[model samples]
Target: MDNNKRKLTEKELKRKNDFEKISSEMQQKGYKIKNMTINIQQANFLGPLSMLPFITLTFLFYHNVNGFDLGEISLGFVVAAILFIPLAILHELIHGVTWGFFAKNHFHSIEFGFIWSSFSPYCTCSEPLEKWQYLLGTAMPTLVLGGGTAVVSVMTNQLLLFILAEYMILSGGGDFLIILKSMLYRTDKQESVYCDHPYECGFVVFEK
Candidate 1:
C-alpha cells in the first residue's frame, strides 16, 4: 500500500507528534528508541497464511485423539459459528483491557475501532510501555481466548469449541506477526519499550 508514500492528515500528524513526544521523553530518560512499521496489506495477507500449521495440528489432533465427524454440523454448529462475530470484537477488547493497565491514561489511552481498508478491527494503545507489557497485551487474547478454549475443547471433547479455539488462534495471525518481528529485531539492551505507530497498523520499539 505504499505506506511510505502515504500522506498524513492533521489528526494523524498530531498523533504522531504525541507518540514521538513520549518516545523522546523515554530517550531522555536513558532508553534507546527503535521504530517498527507494520504493513497492513502484508499483515492481512500473512495472518491467515500463518494459520496453516495450527489448522493442520487441530485437524490431526481431532482425527487421532477424537474423531471429527462432518455430520456433527447442525443448528448448534451454526449458532457457534455466529459467535465468531462477537469473539472478533472480544479479541480487541482483550488487547485494550490488558494494555490499559500499563498505560498512563489507563483505559482512556486504548482506542478500539475497525480498519475499513483491511476490514479488520484493532485495539491500539496511545501510550508507550515496557516491551514485556506490550508483549503481554498482544499475546493475551491468543493465550486466554484461543489457548484456553483449546484446553476446554480437549477436556470436554467438544468439536465446536475446538473449532472456535482454532479459529481464534488463527485469527491472531497479526499479533503473532508483530511478536515475531519484535523478537527477530530485538536489541540486546536491558531496557526497552514499545508503542503503537500513530498512523500505522504496527508498533514502534524503544530500547537501551
Candidate 2:
C-alpha cells in the first residue's frame, strides 16, 4: 500500500526501515506508543496572530506620525510591519502543502496559535510519514516561508520586513522542535504507522 510516487534515497530508506524495526521491537518488548489528536485550527489562527506583537511593537514604539494610530504609537515602520501577518499565513500554507502532497487524502485540520508563548502552524495527516518526509515537511515552512521572507526583505532593504521575518523564524515553534527532540531521544523521528499525537504520523508542524 505504499505510494512510490516520491523516490527516497538509500540512506533515507534505511532510516525508515530502521525506525520501523525499532518501533516494532519496542512494542513487542512492552513499550507503549500511543497516537494523540492534534488541533490544527488552533495552530492556524495562533500562528498568524503571533506576528501581531511585532507589528504592534513597531507601530507603538517606532511610528513617526500619530493621532488616529489605532492604538499605535508610531508609524515610521508601518510599511514593513504589515507584511508579518501575510508572512505568518504563508508559513502555515507551506506546511499544508507539504503535508497534503505527501499524505494525499490524509489531511485532518490546521491549527494556528501562540502555543507555549510561540507562534506556529501545523497540519494533521492520516498516518506518520517517513522520517525524511517528516523532517522535510516540518522544515519546509521555515526555509520557504521564513527564509523567503527574509531574503525578499533584504533584497528590498525593508527593515520592518526583516524584523518580522526574523521574529517568525525565531519564535515560531511546533513539529520542528519535536523533530529535534526525537533526534535527541534516538527514537523514530517520524511517527510510526497508525500512530497519533502532536508529533504523530499524520501531521507536520511549522513555526510562524
Candidate 3:
C-alpha cells in the first residue's frame, strides 16, 4: 500500500508540473497575442490611407509615361471592379467551409463596413477547438483568397485582378494577423487573440 501511495504521489507531481508549464506558456503567448493585436489595429488605420498615396503615384506614372491608352481604362476596369465583390465573398466562404469540416457543430459569421471589416468573422464550435483545427480555420481565407487570386492573375494576366486580391487581404486587416498567430499557436500551443464576443457587430453567421 505504501508503494502504491508513493507512485500516486509521483503521478500527481508530474501532472502538476506539466500543468504549470502549460499555464506559463499560455501567459507568455497571451502577451504576444496582445501585441500582435495592437499591430494589426494600427495597420488598419494606416494601410488604407497609405494606399491613397500609392493611387496618386499610380496616376503620376500613368501621366508621365507615354502611349497610356485611356481607352483601356473604361469598360475592362469597370467589369473587373464588378467581379471583385463576388471574389471577396468567396474568400470568406472558404474560411467558413473549411472550419465546418473539422467542427461538426461549427458556426461562422462575417461583417462588412465602409471603413473596416467590422470584426465579427467567427468560428464557434461545441467547445474550444484543438489547436490545429483552429489554426486551419483561421488561415483558410488568406490561402484561398491569396492563392485563388494568384492563379487567376496569372491566367488572366490582369493587373486589376491582382489589386482586387490585395484589397481583399488588406480589408481583412486585423483578422489576417489573428489568423497568422492562430496558425503559429497550432504548432506552439500559444495563446492567441480570438473573438470572445462574436455577435456584437452585424455579421453573417454560419453554422454547421
Candidate 4:
C-alpha cells in the first residue's frame, strides 16, 4: 500500500502538530528532524527473509550434535500452530505493556487491535519517549518470550520449547528491523526521541 497517499485523521494531525512543536525547538538548536515508519504488509512478507540467518545458523549449530527427525520437527510445528493464536495476542500485549510503563499517560497511551492486511495484531504507544525507553519496549517480546525460551530450550533440550522460541523469534522479525534502525540512527545534538506510530507496526523517531 502507498502509505504516503493516505489522508491523516484528525488525531494523527494533532499528534503531528504536537511533535512538530518539539521539532521546531530542535531546529532552533541546529538539529534536524526526520520521520520513520514501516509498512505492515510489506514487513509481514519479509518476515521469513529477515529470520533467515538466525534460523540457519541455529539449525547449523544443532546439526553438529543432533540428527534430524522428521517426526519431531512435525510435532514441533503442530505445537507451534496450536499456540500461534494465543502467542500472537501475547506478542502485541507485550509491546503495549512494556511501552506503557514508560508512557507519560501510562496504559492510556497504548492501543491494541488486529490488522487484516498483515494478519497480525498491533500495539501502538501514542506517547513519545527517550531512545532507550522505546528500544527496551520494542525488544521485550522477542527478548522475554523469544530469546528467553530459546535459552530454556537449549538448556533442557526440549523440542517443544525450541519450536516455541523459533516461532516467537520469527514473530519479531519486524521488531528486529525497527530496533536496528533506531540504534543505527545518529544525532550530533545528543537528544533522540521515539514514539509508536498511531497505527503502523513501527515507530516514528527524531534525533536532535
Clashes of each: 0, 26, 1, 0
- Model 2 steric clash total: 26
Scored by Cα lDDT, where does model 1 land?
0.80
Off by over 4 Å in 3: 1-43, 46-85, 106-127, 180-208
lDDT of each: 0.80, 0.49, 0.45, 0.75
Which one wins on lDDT?
Answer: 1
**Which candidate do you rate higher for lDDT, 2 or 4?**
4
Candidate 2, residues 53-130, lDDT tens digits: the string is: 544654343333322333222442464366655666676677667766676354543333333333433343334555
> Cα miss at 161, model 4 (Å)?
1.4
Q: Which candidate number maximizes TM-score?
A: 1
The segments of candidate 1 whose C-alpha lies over 4 angstroms from its true place after superposition are 1-4, 7-14, 73-81
- Decide which is better by TM-score, 1 or 3: 1
Residue 6 displacement in candidate 2 (angstroms): 39
Instruction: List CA RMSD, all candidates.
Output: 2.8, 12.3, 14.5, 3.4
**Predicted candidate 1 versus true structure: per-residue lDDT over 87-181, tens digit per residue:** 88999999999999888889989887776655667788988888889989998998888888877887787888887887888888889888888
lDDT tens digits, residues 1-208, model 4? Answer: 1238667656656656665665667578765556667665677778657877777665665555454567888999998999898998998899889889988899988877775644767777777788888989988998988888877777666767777888888888898888877777666766667877654457776565
Selected candidate, larger TM-score, 3 vs 4:
4
- Which 10 consecutive positions of candidate 2 have the poorest summed lDDT? 199-208
Model 4 scores what on Cα lDDT?
0.75
